[model samples]
Target: MIVKKRRRPLPLTVLSTTFVLLWVLMAAFPFIWTVWGSFKVEQDFFSRDSWWFAIEGPRTIAQTGSAFTGDGYYGAWVLRDFFSSVVNTIIVTVSVVVISLTFGTLGGYALARSGYRYTFWLLMLALVFRAMPHITLVSGYLLPFFEMNIWGHLPTAIIVLVAINQPFTLWMLHSFFLSIPKDLDESAMVDGCSRFQAFRMVVIPVMWPGVITTGLFSFLLAYNDFAVTAMLLSQPNQTMVPKIASFLGTIQQEGNVMFAVAAVVSATAPLFVLVMFFQRQIVSGLTAGAVKG
Candidate 1:
C-alpha cells in the first residue's frame, strides 16, 4: 500500500477559522444570553453577585415551581397584546414584498433589455434615492400623508416601504436579469410567445433564485424598520420592533424587563428560522451573478 501523508492547515486558514468562530460567538452569544435570561426574574438575571444565577434558575424555579418559566412570553404576548403587532408586521412585510417585487421585476427587466440611453440616467437616479437616508424621505411624506388623512395606517406604511424598497430592488433584480442569457427569452419569442409570455414562461422560473434573494432582503427591511414605523404608525398599528422599543421606555416604571427580553427573543426566532430554512437559496441567489457560467 502507498504511504499516506497528512497536510497541515496553512496559517492563513487557521487564522481565518479562528476569526470566524470568534465573530459567530460575538454575534450569537447575546441572543443566547437573552433567551436564557428571559426565563428568569429580573433580580436573578441581572444580579451582580454571580452570572451563573441565570443559568442556575433557582429563583425561576421558585416563582414558577419549575426550572424555567414562560411568564415573560405570556405577559408580553397575551397580556400586552403583542400578537396584534405581529399581525401588523406581517401585513406590512408581505404587502411591501409583493408590491416591491412586482414593480422591481418589471423595471429591472426593462432596464436590462432596453438599449436606450435614458436607462443609465434612470438607474443613476435610483442610486441617488437608495443612498439617501430613509428617515429624510419619511419627513417629506409626513405632511402629505397628514393632508391625505392616511397617516398611521397599514396602507400608508406599506406604500412608503414599497417606494423606499424599490430602488435597491430594481438594482438587484437588474443585475440578476443581466446574469441570465438574453437568448432564452428570444428563443421563447421565436416559438410564438409574446414578450410577456416569454418572460413568464422562460425568464421568471430562472429568475426566482435572484427574486427570492431580493424578497428576503425586502422582508428584512420591512420587518426590522423602527424609524419609519415608529414615526408613521399609530399606537394600535405598531410593529414588533417599535413595540419592543416602547417596552424600553416603560420597563423602568413597569418592572417588566423580562417581557422586553421575551419579545426580542420572539421577534428573533422567526428570522432565525427563516435564515436556517432558506440559507441555501440565499447563498445561491447572492452568488448567481458572481460567475457567468
Candidate 2:
C-alpha cells in the first residue's frame, strides 16, 4: 500500500519581516532623532521638557510654517575650525587603520601558524594585553609624555589612539588567519614559496576581506572617540570629536554650526562606501571562514 506524504508548512516570512523591521527601527532611531534635531532650532531641542515624543512642542525658532529648520547644520558648516576637525579625524582614522591592520595581520599569522604550545603562550599574552584597560595604558603614559611637551598634542594623541585600537585588531585578524586551512600554506611552500612569502602571497589575498572588515571597525573607533583625544590632544588644531565635545561646553553653544554639521557628515559617507566596496568580499570571506564545506 502506498502512503500519502504530509506537506511541510510555509516559512515564517511575515514574522521574519517584522523582526527585521523592529531591528531597523531600533538602530535608526537615534540617527533619525539626531537628523531631526539638527534641522530644528535650539529652542525646540530644549523647550520640550518631556521625554515622550510629540508632533509639536514650543515655537522656539519663531518660524512661521515648519518646525524643521536648517539653522543648526548651517552654523556647523560655515566655519574653518569645523573643517580642521574633519581633517584631524581623517588623519587619526587613517593612521589607526593602517598601523593596526599591518601589525595585526603579522601577529595574527604568527599566532595562527605556530604550534599549540606557542599558541597558548601567545593567546595568554593577547588576553593580558586586551584585558588591560585603555585607561591603565593612558594613565601610565599620560604624565611622562605630558612632561615631554608632546602628550597634550595631535601627534601623541594619534599614537595613543593607534595603540588603543591595536589589541582588538590583533585578535580579530588572528581568528581570521586561524580559519584558513593549513593545506594552503603547505601547497604554497611545495611550490617553492618561503613561509613568509607564502603568507604574503597566499594568506594576504585570502584574508583581504577580514582586513577590510577590521579596518572599518578600527576607523570608526578612532573617528568617533572623544575621551583619549580630549585627554591627549587639547589644542584647537588637533581633532574633531573632542572639538565637537568641547564646543558643547561653551556658553554660545547654539552658534557652533560647524560642529553639528561636521558630526553628521563625518562618518556618513566613508562607512557607506567602505561597506559597498567590500560588499561581495565581506560575504564570501565570512562564509568561507565559518563553514567547513
Lowest summed-lDDT stretch of 10 residues in model 1?
Answer: 284-293
Q: Judge candidate 1 at residue 177 and give its lDDT.
A: 95
For each candidate in turn, give its C-alpha RMSD to the true structure in angstroms: 3.3, 5.2
- State the number of backbone clashes in model 2: 4
**Per-residue CA lDDT of candidate 2, range 143-197, in tens?**
8986887876666777777777777766777778878998998899999999989
Give the deviation of candidate 1 from the true structure as CA RMSD: 3.3
lDDT for residue 149 in candidate 1, whole number 0-100: 95
lDDT of 1 by residue, 1-293 (tens): 99788776799789999999999999999988998888887767887778888899777778778878888899899988899999999999999999999999989999999999999999999989999898898899899999999999989999989998989888889988998999999999999999999988899999887898999988988998887999899999999999999988888744388889889999999999998999987676566545532
By TM-score, who's the top model here?
1
Using alpha carbons, what is the TM-score of model 1? 0.91
